[model samples]
Target: MQGDQASVIGGAIEFIKEMQQLFHSLERKKKRRRSLSPTPSPKPPSLAAGELAAFCRSAAADVEAKISGSNVMLKTLSKRIPGQVVRIVAVLERQAFEILHLNISTVEDTVLYSFVIKIGLQCQLSVEELALEVQHSFSQESAF
Candidate 1:
């Protein structure tokens, strides 16, 4: 009975050591993951963001007015502005695909881009030359 008791005590000590090692390993992995994690993203713009939203809506309305006044249906186009990438989709014959994908870094780039796209829709400039022509034309405008 004494020998059996010694063996049982030794087994418990080994079990406890294993548990401690497991806990230590888990803690090390957690610390490694934390250190490798990316910097936190900025907090999203607050309710004051609505001011920018309203301005965008107004600009969209102006563009809508321009397209609607002509034969083109502006409603058929969809836009996705995700961060610095601007994607414009146009549907034709029941199919939809992106027509414009512009990477813009500032409000000015977006504003100028909108003007370029609007003029491209109205003119004979080839797809290859449209961007340059639009930039040149917008640059010539006094309001810009």
Candidate 2:
């Protein structure tokens, strides 16, 4: 009886040790995978307001404004604003442009993005058009 008890205890200790080793190995594998994965480069901040607006207008016209995200509140013509990154908060499709709202807040207001301006988290606009529009818009603002 004593010998049998000793064997059982030893087997239980061995099983516990094996489980600990297996857990350690799994943790090591996860760490290795995390280290080996490639890191993506950061995207440049979108500052070209005119190009963004034009891109919004043309792209909105092209796709018939079928987009989704934080922007969903600006359905009226008066609510639409150019030259800003309006994150789509919600969406409702119409014949022409998608009605969207944003998820941003200000000292006096809470604004919505109101369009498919940024497709899949990145705003789409051609570089040359963007540069030209930015210059023009800034000049216009300065003159005003």
Which window of ten consecutive residues has the lowest lDDT sum in model 2? 71-80
lDDT of 1 by residue, 27-105 (tens): 5434644699654422222323212111112212112111212222121111223321112222111122223322221
- Candidate 1 — which residues are off by over 4 angstroms? 37-144
Which one is best on lDDT? 2
What is the Cα-based lDDT of residue 117 in candidate 2? 35
> What is the lDDT for 106 in model 1?
26
